[model samples]
Every structure is written in C-alpha cells, then in structure tokens.
Target: MWLPQPVHALPERLAQLIWGWALAWWRIVYLGAVVLVLVLSPSSYSRVGRHLLARRMYLDTLPILLGFTALAALLSLIITRIVVVTALSYGLSRYALEMVIRVLVLELIPLTAAMFVAMRCAIPSGAQLAQLRRSGRLVVLERTGADPVRMELLPRVVAAGFASVTLAALSCVVALAMAYFSVFGLGTAGLVSFTRMFGHVFSPEVTLVFVLKTVFFSLAIAVIPMTAGMYDLGASERRSELGGLARMFAVLLLIELVSLVGNYY
Candidate 1:
C-alpha cells in the first residue's frame, strides 16, 4: 500500500533539518534492529523485518561508525591532553589515568556518544517517520495489502539500533588505545598495569553487565526515537517529536543507576 507522501515546500534550512531527520531515521532503524535481536528474539515473522533493517543498517551505519569513531577519538585525546595532563602536572598524576578512563572513556564517553548520535541522527529520523505516516503512507500500504508495521517502520528501528552499537564499539576501541597512550605515552610499561586494571574493572559479571548496559543505551536511543515517530502518526504534530527519546532516556538513566549499584555492590 503506497500512502500519499506529499511533496512539501522544502526550504533550504527546513530541507537540511529534514535531511538530518532522514539520516536519524535510517540509523535508528538499522542499528536498533540488530541490537534488539541481540537482546531478544521476536516472532518468526519479525525476522523478515529484521533482515530488511539489517540490510539498511549494513548500507548506512558502517561509514557513520567510522566517522564517529574518528571524531570521538580526537575529542578523547584533547580531553586527556588538557584535563588528564593538567592533573598529572599538579602531582596528581598517579590517579589521573584511571580517573580519566573511568569518567571520560568508560562511563561518560559511551553515554555521550549514544545521546549525541541519537540527537544528531535519531530524532530527525523519528520526525520524518511521523510525517510519513501522516502523509497516509501507512494507509496506502494497507490498501495495497502490505504490512506497514513490519515492512516500513521495523526495519528503520532496527537500523537506528545497529548504528548506535557499532559506533559504541568503535569508540570504545579508540578509547582503549588512547587510554594507553594518554597514560603511558606509547611506552610498554603501562600495558601490564593497564591490562590488570582493565581485568579488575571488567570481570566476567562486570563485563556482562557493561555489555548489557550498552545494549540498553543503544535500545533506548533507538526505541525512543522510533516511538516518537510512530506516536506522531496518531497525535498532534506540534509536540510529538522524540516520543521515544523521553522513554528511552528514562530507561537509560535507570540502567546507569543499576550499573552503578552493581558495580559498587
């Protein structure tokens, strides 16, 4: 069913705005679907939607992940050079690296990356989706005897999730390498301690929890945007954006709280 997707008056600024939204939608669906499968298996029929989502994600998310990783690496390095180094110069260097890694790399970096990615790409995606539905695209599909839910939206949700997870993993790898150089200055002396510290910080259970937390963060990022987009299909457009983000962020915070609790537990 092809719904009436009208051609709007696309002004340059609004067009740019719409483009951002479009990018967000694709990433949110692509990335979100992959991560969701990792979380739980839906019904067999959902697999087709997942494949579509995965395909979109494969085409779109990989390049974004690489770009984001590069950008994040640069940001982490700048922070380390200034904040971490300054602390060290003040004779507080002994505690600098671990603290930096904990705050900037492990905890803060991942959250920041997810949120930034969501806002940068997912929010716009959500809005466009809402507009698509409003334009009667969903109804059009129904008339054509097609499933709008699985065929149209599910793939998008999956893509958003996939983008988030892939980007996070890429950023983490960059952070790990940067952490070593930030502390040890490209020397081998820090590898032993770094490995030990890493091992201590991320044990079996801890590692599991960490992975879970990231997945939630990724899911929230995707789910919120998609929810917002879909909700708009049924509500007033003026205030319907980011419906999923609100719920997603709340859950993301809860997951963080849980992670902290378990870590200190």
Candidate 2:
C-alpha cells in the first residue's frame, strides 16, 4: 500500500508549511514587541509592578546585562563598520546606511541579542533549575514552606530578562552610532536626514512594537528554560540537561518567529 509513504511524507510537508508560516508571522512579532516592553516597563507600572520588575529585571541580572550590553555594542560597531566599508569599497556606498539599517537594526541585532542570551544564560539557567528539581531541592523547599518564586526562579528569571534587554538596547545604540559615522564620516551633516529616517523607522508604533518584542524575547529566553527545568525536576540528570537545551532553543526560535510575524504583518 502507499499508506506508509504518504504518512512519512506528511511530516515533511507539515514541517515545510510550519517553517513558511513562521517566516510570514515573524515580522509582525518584531513590530509589536517594542510597545509590549514599554507598556510593561518598570516606569509604566506601579508598586505591584516593582515586584514584577524585580522578578523580571534586578541586581542579580545586572552583571550579565552589563557584559552583554558591552559585547553587543562592540559587535554592532564592528559589524556595521564592516558592512559600510565593504559597500564603499565596491562603489556602492549609497546602499551602506540603508543596508546597515535593514541588516543590523531591523533584523540582526534583536535576533542576535536574543540568541546570545539564550545560549549563554538561558541554557545554563535551565540546567541549574533542572538539577535543583532533580535533586528534590524545589520540593524540599516546599516541605519547609519555602517559596521557589523568590529563592530560585526570581533571580534567574530577572537576570535572563535584564541581560536580554540590556544587550538589545546597547546593540541598538551602537548600530545607530555606527550607521552615523559610516554614513556621515565624523560630521553632524547627515543629522537631519538620518534622524528623520530613524524617526521614520522607529515610529511611536514601531518603538512600541520593538519594546514589546524585546521584552517578550527576554521572557521567552527566561521562561522556556525555566519551564523545561521544572519538567526535568526529578528526572534523570542526562535527560534534564538535554531537555533544558532543547526547550531553550525551541523557545528562542518560537520567539523569533513571533517577532517576525508581528513586524511584517
């Protein structure tokens, strides 16, 4: 019968469809992200918000955020500079800023910052949480009537988020500066037009979208690993490790897809 062949082909076809759909929806997610973050930003909220702020972004998270912010800024400068130089060398300097804007700011920086944190902290945080769960530490705390939210989850979650946002913001600043110098070359001459373009692309709506997207990007990085870690608790160590990485990467990709859709559509 042809049934087995059809069944086998089904998964492949489904995968292709999913992948295509993901690409289509991802832009919308990016466009929607900024607003989400701004609305949920610490300044936007009240005292109750402070607790959420601590949970999402706090001192413990500061170190990683600082490190990532610096890293992202440097990387943005290097990458943008390279693109500009390459363009000018090829006698296509006109395309430099626009290409840099599209590449570094619109797509690469946001995604890159997310991916970096996901790899560095998200995976490790998952492993740590999963190990705690496997060791029954989470349960034991419960026996003693302890709060996992404060002792364990909060710190890591906060760190993951702050790091994500810090890196993202830093990268954006660097990208803007790199674009400036690359285009205007040590002058304030392109200030008006460049600023206009910046304003054009970063409309209040776009900014709102980007804020939402970045925050969610942070959330995904933090939450997915934590979720996986929760499941891995009380499981085999190897299984927990594998599960953490798998879940973190999966969540990162899902976030990326969501942002993409929100941006374009």
Q: Which candidate leads the pack in lDDT? A: 1
Best by TM-score: 1
lDDT measured at residue 2 in model 1 versus the true structure, 0 to 100 = 80
For 1-265, candidate 2 gives per-residue lDDT tens digits of 5645667798999997687446433532442354345545555445644565575455445556667667756766777788888988999886677767766776678777877887877668767877898788998988897655445665576677778877888778876886788668888889998887777777676677678878877877766566556553343546545644665567667766776687667
Q: What is the C-alpha lDDT of each candidate?
A: 0.70, 0.68
Q: Model 1, clash count?
A: 32
Query: Model 2's lDDT to the true fold?
Result: 0.68
Error of 2 at 53 (Å): 8.3
Worst 10-residue lDDT window, candidate 1: 231-240
TM-score of each: 0.74, 0.68
Decoy 2 TM-score against native: 0.68
